[model samples]
Target: MSKTTPKYLLLSLPTSVVPSHHADDALEAISTTVSAENGSAAPFSIPEFKIGTLDALVQQADELAKLESQCQGVVAKVADALRNILDGDEAQIERMMVVNDKPVDQYLRTFQWNKVKYRADKSLAELIDLLHKEGASIDNDIRFKYSQYNQVKNTLATLQRKQTGNLSTKSLASIVDPRTVVQDSEYIETHLIAVPNSQEKEFLKNYETVAPMVVPRSASLVASDNEFTLYAVTTFKKHSVEFVHKARENKWIPRDFKYVEGGKEEERKEVERVGGDERKVWGETLRLGRTAWSEAVMVWIHVLVLRVFVETVLRYGLPLDFVSALVRTPSSKQADKAKKNLDDKYSYLAGNAFGRDKKGRVQRDDPQDMHGAGEGSAEYTPYVFYEFEFN
Candidate 1:
């Protein structure tokens, strides 16, 4: 407490522990210095000693190291927790079934059984036969029988329909005739169909007896040899027709569609005329192939809100207290607006709080229900109700 006493020693020791004599000595010296500098009558008070530079630096370094260790531990725990959350059996199953591809409903509907049939070299007839052999009676049900009959009828009908001239058994036979076998001239030729009217003509045209062939016009068949070319071409054409029919059924093109000549050129010109800003706006709608701007805006807003909420939770844990405060605040209008935004954005979070499952049925994880204020409900539900309550 002497005038020469070091600041560190004074600061390191407590005020209460400092001797009264020393404090009096320090205060008197400080008062004299202040009086001389200010030339004032008022006595000066000595300020409390502050920690020295070396001590402060050492303390800060120690705290920083401790903080670093704590942060590392927290990071490790979070990583393990996230991995466990993502790698759980249910999560893995959901990831495989839902995330890796389209939803189960979409997969089941869009799955091309026809493509599978073609790849496997299996006919619809063979499939039906196998089913029948397995005791699956497709005959008992009239609808089933009708469906099968209609399919066969349709195939034959399509073939007959495509015929250009007068239909005849001979002509039909010619179209559907299988590939000719390469053999010696001595081998006897087998006739699958011998129409009465064409027997003499058939005998006269024996050397010109061609097997039934379907010629397709697809690019895939362009390089095929003549022996297999017809089959490939026919298959491609049939498939193309089927695809176009399906597209039409799905309303992919307008019913009043007129074939556009140089449509891409027109589109490019329109884009250029519209300039960059309008072009971007037009591009978003075109890219999504839809015209619901409000819905798109809502979706983007929801994504942004969810992203912020997730980042907040990941950084500082769930903001339940802040959310509750916001919900219960006196500014009902602001609260209502906030709740509306949340309902539009985070309704899925609410749905996850209350949802059910049934056997053999695709369960909805989120169910839409009444939300927001002044809707005959005194209590309001938080988005993370289940997480906050249970966790």
Candidate 2:
């Protein structure tokens, strides 16, 4: 409700350390150590994917890791956009991520690793490629849909603005009476003028003498608001331009209007049409946003799983054995504690690749030292780790 997205830490460890029967023990240990009052964890299902050659898997690991970050960013952005569309409702239902039409938290708890959707027969590289392509496609689609909705919404707003503005700027279509307009008269032309409320009596007194051939007593009040009064007047057709100029010089606003049959009705119809268009687009954009968020989250998780599989192989070397998990902390402090506990427990996984500082903590190499390590190797944690938020 406070707009703080729910954060989760994703981790994967070698199977040798966490046997199948005790799979939940590692997560339980981390949660209990972090905050027994607010921390939770679940089995993050990662299907045994086919690992191609070592070189290809390493390259794809780096690419998929970056893709995971991208997917995370896309999910957050789409959530924010959807939140705005919901009128900043802090308690909106879309605060949670969904996958397969189920909330992400529930899905993770009951995860069975959809082997049908992502065939394990396919190489891990192919699966990573597929997930990356889907994530990119979803991101592009959400952007386009949100943009289109804004365009239609803006069009409707512009139309509504003219209906509510002051006399000098508002549309006169619905206010001007057909009978008050001098229609189809060759000698007499009807002109609409907006005079300030303070100058109404002055306009009424001098309108007849402002220009040549003005009809006496032809001026009639058409409409009025707090700041201005609209009046319709008749004058000789030849003096129409001069009449408007003199009216402006006298601090009155001359409005351009062409009389049309059923103009008011037409204005109503136009508003209805645009209003309907805006509503339709709004519904579509909202639906698209929801679907895109789910797709992006799933793709992001898949990329993370791929990173875990590949990194586990590269780091642990082999027989396709590791335990992956999802950890949820109620607060950032708990998240920090979970990270610290996990680091202390798994620092040995890094082995000789990472060194120790005077504080006896595993000192991760700086980005500069990680150069040529790989594209996604810039940040090297003891074990496979990624975090994302959904609120």
Candidate 3:
């Protein structure tokens, strides 16, 4: 490859995951990469590849995601063993569920220890070796880069959602445009503040008196819920810090509702640049016969494929809606057509996958299992495809 050439992968793995009765059945496919096969020829050779960087990142992301899925069985087994050891076998299974970072750390520790354990039986040792090798794929570095990629991707999605008027209900109802908030008066800043539901009346009656007293009628209530009452609070920009502290004293919770300035984007960008080896593969179907791929289809496929990819790979670990929201299909009847096209495409991998039916509710045998990862000794429900509709 020339010095100017960028990395790419020639992926041909099945769109949906297939269960391997024996863990080693899929290892060879996982270890293969298109870049490894023919060095000089670019993967599929995009015609004037316009979205090379973004597409490359998505491919890398998918590759990592696929590795995670293949490794799930081994990881799931390790997590269950550790959770059982920590919670004791006698505890109610529900109470022993491990759902967050704390318990995951415990599972990781035990898993690493198992990797180092001494075993005499050849079969047992070989199984342990497989787990250890797979475990290496999910080490801190992969997890770190993968998480950063998700954070950045999610941040971009949030911005796009806002642009498309698809922001969260809370954000839409309570967040005033910063530009509108600064109306007429240039010195005042309007903040979207949330005060405790219990303190709603207190804020109405005493916020002005408690916060060194001000005019413009204290604060205007924008929206409310059982737990919080959103408010548009205005004060001189110079005194905003003191005003914030004063509001806090009266039970207002600080939330930086400004998604653009919320720092997640900046943090995500800083972390995303730290690339990993998994991102070398550019497209799953970009190999030999698929060389006719175009830039536009590739972009749409990236979103659609990653939505299905992450959904299946991290089924138990991600939100049920997953990345389905980011899948850009047509606006009307064609949307339904596109959804069907995707659904039919993966129909072969349907048996092991979890999905949402025509209704929005996720189709699952156990509802609580949706809590993910630490919920039980459950296996990942593969091929987790969801309809391309939003609530």
Off by over 4 Å in 3: 1-180, 183-185, 216-218, 254-391
* Best-matching candidate per lDDT: 2
The order by descending lDDT is: 2, 3, 1
Per-model TM-score versus the true fold = 0.14, 0.77, 0.29
Identify the runs in model 2 with alpha carbons over 4 angstroms from their true place: 1-3, 15-38, 90-92, 95-97, 177-222, 231-255, 352-356, 360-362, 365-379
List the global CA lDDT of all models: 0.28, 0.77, 0.39
Extract clashing residue pairs from model 3: 9-280, 9-281, 9-282, 60-279, 98-374, 353-382
Best TM-score among the predictions, by candidate number: 2
Tens-place lDDT digits, model 2, residues 20-45: 43556765555555555546767777
Ranking 1 against 2 by lDDT, winner: 2
Task: Give the CA lDDT, 0 to 100, for residue 99 in model 3.
Answer: 29
